[model samples]
Target: MITLKFKKFNIEAYKPGKSRVKKLRKVIKLSANESALGLSPKVKRLISNKKLILDKYPDGKSKDLRKAISKTYNCNFEKIICGAGSDEVIQMICQLFLNPKDEVVLPEYSFLMYRIYSKVVGAKVVFSKEINFKISIKEILKKVNKKTKIVFIANPNNPTGTYLTKKEVLELRKKLNKNILLVIDDAYAEYMKNSDYSSGLNLFKNKDNVFILRTFSKIFGLASLRVGWGYGSKKIIDRLNLIKPPFNVNRIAQLAAVEALKDKKFVNRSIKHNFFYANKIKKFLEKYNIFSNTVSANFLFLNFEKCRYSSNFFYQKLKSKGIILRSTKDGYHINNRLRLTIGSSKENLKFMNTVKGIFD
Candidate 1:
């Protein structure tokens, strides 16, 4: 047999969240933290453009897409870079900054992709403890040292759905070494109505080391398109540009995202619906004795820690009934918790009723 070799087991493969199961006739998918209101109708209208050329190469820089994102968000156009998703942009950061033995700091239960990409680039991952399901600034500061090169914080953290206030974030920045890159992954930024939260874009003006990673997949309802963009200082932008793959973001995704940004009405509708139904689900769950920690994103992290049954048991039970919710096992590292994305009003009601049937 030919010898099989890898980088001596450099990385464990990533486990993406579960997709909606399709066997059942009626299904309510609240697993992935995707928009309860799907893709913008304007984006949907663009899908039938039959005259567009299919075989042409996309603009390698994705200039128009970047300009649209910049104009919509009041950001510097030249400073933004697009990727297949923010996930690819994140991996590029790892490749550009991480040496064979450098260390990257993260929240104890932040996004799982950060850990996976760090390991692939031969970097060590350091996790800071969370306080009451929020990323604790004190714990994160304590984890820093001479070896630390990057600190990845996913604001309104996935699975947990809690966020760090802007004051706490700026304080963390003041204490950390300026040499270390501070990456803010703001995937669910638009869904948040928290008045004290900022997206770290303003932080980039005064701080040489701040970088913001954002995704069209979340609030834009373009999850299927896999388009995302990043903001940073010119030096960081240049480095990432040189390292990213050619035509990394496809033409279709770029076009869809550009349109997604133009339609603020649809985005506002999604935000309103998410806000309304998410709280509705929260109250319903509380009535049935299920509770969650404070959440500021599009999902809920149900506290099942006190229950006799495992999270897996609840996951499988819901799966059997055609209601899909996320078990914390997708590498978020928070045991005894289940994350359920807020679906449409009808979907949310069905999910809650299904749970009541099981437990009540």
Candidate 2:
């Protein structure tokens, strides 16, 4: 037999939140951290109006969407570069900055994509230590070296739902080497209503090394359309635009994104729902002694490391009840943790009752 030869990079593929449960009639999927409210009806109505344009090639530059986003966020449009999602934009950044044996620094239990993308380009992945699920900038500084090319910080980090304040982030920038690129991934920024938390977008204005990433997938509820964009210095934005494929964002997605940005009412509703229900769920689980850290994002990360039941036990029990949640063991590298998305009011109530039954 002839030997088959293929060059495969050494890296773990990004594991998305678990979904697709079969044989469950009333399955409430709270695994992906997706918006329970979903896309606004106004977006659907606008998309429906644009049915005639589906036959044509989309605007390659995504000019309209960029303008809309810039207006909504009150940022400079020249610094904007859109992509299929934050994932693709991050891939582009890695390919541009990383070489074989180069290094990327990130916190432990952070978003997996940063590590996976860095490794895909043959770059070394370095993990910084965390304190009680919060990223320690001191630990991150210790990990950075001459080989480090990029630093990825997920504000309101996933699987933990904790955040660093603006002052803390600025201190990180001051301490890092000027040559290294700093990427701020703010996928959950919209869900957060706190004044103390900042997306670090201002860094893009003054710092040539800073890049701020935002997504329409989370608060805009356009996960299916996959619209993500980044803000950086003009030079960096120009480089990314050069490498970004023409028509990377489809016409439909672009249109929907513009309308989604304009619908302030919808965003307000989603924020309210997330806060009210996330707190409600956390309080309800208190009787079980299942505690979650204060979360600014749209999900609650319940720590079951010392609970009456193992994480796997609670997962299987909920799965059997037609309820689904995200476990952190396999993908997130955290044990005895479950991430529960703040679903609609009805779904949240159902979840509370269903979970309470397990203790009974």
Candidate 3:
């Protein structure tokens, strides 16, 4: 018998939100924070084009997509690096900066990919405490030391809809060690209409130590395409390009992302729709004593502590009705809470009706 030796990691694998229910052929899924409106009409048209060639490999550098992104965001094209998703960008950053025993700091509850990718590179994951489910700059500062290599944050953070103010985020960047890289994920930025908030790309476009991650998944309604891009100093982007997988993004995904960026009308409609529905749902949930954070992102972080029923009870009730929501217990470990993704008009109506039935 031959024995094989390999590196072992104790990291907990990432579990995506549930999408299926037993004994149901179809279900209204509000578990994942996906785009409620689905893909842009332009993208749908592009995908349906019969003239597109599939035999040739996609451009390794994703030049056309980068150009579209540059035009949309008013950023330098040379500084952008495309990826399969922002998840891939996180992994590359970890590989480039983390060494065995190096420390990476992030909020106690954030996008799980930050900690997962950091751990894969043999780095120690240090979680900074969040106050009232909001990322605390002071707590993060307290955790930073000479060993800290990178800090990751998602504005309008995931699982919890709380966000740091623009002033607060700027202050955090200023106070951090100059040598430490700050990676900010702006996955839900398009949905945010808060006056006090700003996307990472807008705030840190010229900063060398700050890298911003943007995705087509959330607001652009291209989750299945797996297209994301990173913006940083040209020096870092040039280096990242070296390790980036050749043809990481498929041809159709690149084309779709480009078309998605060009359709400003669609983006605006989605934003308006998200805000209107999120506010309506938030108020409705409050009547039942199911409190949530202020409206900032596309989803609401529902707290069931003050509600008449337990989170588990509500979850099971909705599941039996073929309505799925993300329970904070699975991986997030946030007891008595749920993360509700704002769905389409039909799906949201179904969810609310199902909840009403449960309560009545």
| Number of clashing pairs per prediction, in order | 0, 0, 0
* Clash pairs, model 2 backbone: none
| Candidate that would win on TM-score | 3
If the candidates were sorted by their TM-score against the true structure, best first, what order would they fall in? 3, 2, 1
- lDDT for model 2 comes to 0.88
RMSD of each: 1.7, 1.4, 0.8
Per-residue alpha-carbon lDDT of candidate 3 for residues 1-360, written as tens digits (9 for 90 to 100): 999997877788898989999999899889999999998999999999999889999999999999999998999999999999888888998998899999999999998999899989899999999999999999999999999999999998999999999999999999999999999899999898999999999999999999999999999999988989999999999899888999999999999999999999999999999999999999988889999999988899999999999999999999988989998887777999999999999999888888888888
lDDT of 1 by residue, 1-360 (tens): 898787843555666666667687777778888888898889998866887666998887999999898888888887888999898899898899999789999988888889888988889999899888788988998999999999999887887888888898899888899999999998998888888987777555446688899999888888887899888888888988898898998888988898899899999999999888878888777765578856578999998766655778888889888888887866665677899998887888778788888886
What lDDT would each prediction earn against the true structure?
Answer: 0.85, 0.88, 0.93
How many clashes (backbone atoms < 3 Å, residues ≥3 apart in a chain or on different chains) does model 1 have?
Answer: 0
Between candidates 2 and 3, the one scoring higher on TM-score is 3
Cα TM-score of candidate 3: 0.99
Off by over 4 Å in 3: none
Name model 1 segments beyond 4 Å from true: 20-26, 306-310
Models ranked on lDDT: 3, 2, 1
Model 2: residue 288 alpha-carbon error in angstroms: 0.7
